[model samples]
Target: PGAVLDLSKVIQSFPGVLPKPSFGYAIAMRGGAPNENRYFIDGISIPTVSHFSIQGASGGAVSLVNLDHIQGMDLITGAFPTEVDDALSGVLLLEGRNGRKDRWGLRATQGGTDYGITFEGPIGENTTAVVS
Candidate 1:
């Protein structure tokens, strides 16, 4: 409904995930508290995925991860494997994409509360880089 495409809003559309009754984007999964969930990017644990997150909480008004850079996402609710630690409610895994090696590219985006520019290209013989 707005210019900003929030990740939290998208997550709210999933079944068994409910948005917090109050402000911000904190979510409860399978009747569990929001803080019981965990977030990860490229197998690395991330404390919070939202901007202006609370001291021990995991959500805010906006997401810190850019959707354009994300290649895939996995949402696991309950019965987590050994690799996912401290997840009593759910786990959100974000997989990032590598930059294009064939050529350089640039993109600019304007949102409701922020603006961003992304650049991607080859950094080395076989390595690529993406900066936003």
Candidate 2:
């Protein structure tokens, strides 16, 4: 949460990547080029590394996420276990919270230029989705 994850430091430590306009999308995994990596959002393949520019970097444009709605984050590199393939470099997965399966839940947040809301509840009995 404090900093973005990078693969180069996997053996050294997990460090937070500073949020800046010039920062690249992700670190080169095991010294691989940036373009060789791949990322996903809610299981959807992200064609572009970032949404802000054609270069598709993720530093500035992605800072707009409302942390209140985030469920969890997972960044896997080196030895990925089967379920994930492609991207010889690395993988970043951002998981959002879903229905509570009982009552109802709501989350909202506001930043200088960003705003977001999240609602979770049973659709028919056991189906759920977290809308942003």
Candidate 3:
């Protein structure tokens, strides 16, 4: 898996993040612990951003988020902001894509497990609905 895309490889490219040889995609950042880093989508915290091997929790190979679904990424390091006081090393914030509002849409995700179908449309005049 050394041929991952630039977006998936960007997190380890930061100045203080060190890439380990045997930890899959795991990184030790800012001379801190490997599990010290945190990940968030929108404003909700997730267990990890890396793809799992299905039966175990040891991740770090490839990321779970598709590059096509990302709008932006914020990698915060140092300065210990008061809002996010849990992390000791850094934080990775990911903004997911918001599907088109002009019309209904369907997206398909394949691999790792069974096929996943997502349907999105407007539930009301100002509210959008999505089901997966």
Q: For this target, which candidate reaches the highest lDDT against the unseen true structure?
A: 1
Winner of 1 and 2 under lDDT = 1
Q: Against the true structure, whose TM-score is highest? A: 1
Q: State the local distance difference test value for candidate 2.
A: 0.53
Candidate 1 residue-wise lDDT, 1-132, digit = tens: 442756777678888898886557888888898888888989999877788866555588677777777789988887787998679998998898999999999988766655667899998789999886
Predicted structure 1: clash tally: 0
| Number of clashing pairs per prediction, in order | 0, 3, 1
Looking at candidate 3, the ten consecutive residues that score lowest on lDDT are 52-61
In the order shown, what is each candidate's alpha-carbon RMSD?
A: 2.0, 5.2, 4.3
- Give the per-residue lDDT of model 3 (tens digit) for 37-98: 77788888876666642222323666666654567988887875576789887788888766
Task: After superposing candidate 2 on the true structure, give the runs of residues whose Cα lies further than 4 Å from its correct spot.
Answer: 1-26, 56-60, 64-70, 81-85, 111-113
Question: For model 2, which pairs clash?
Answer: 3-16, 4-17, 50-56
Clashing pairs in 3: 25-60
- The 0-to-1 C-alpha lDDT of every candidate, in the order given, reads 0.80, 0.53, 0.65
TM-score for predicted model 2 compared with the true structure: 0.61
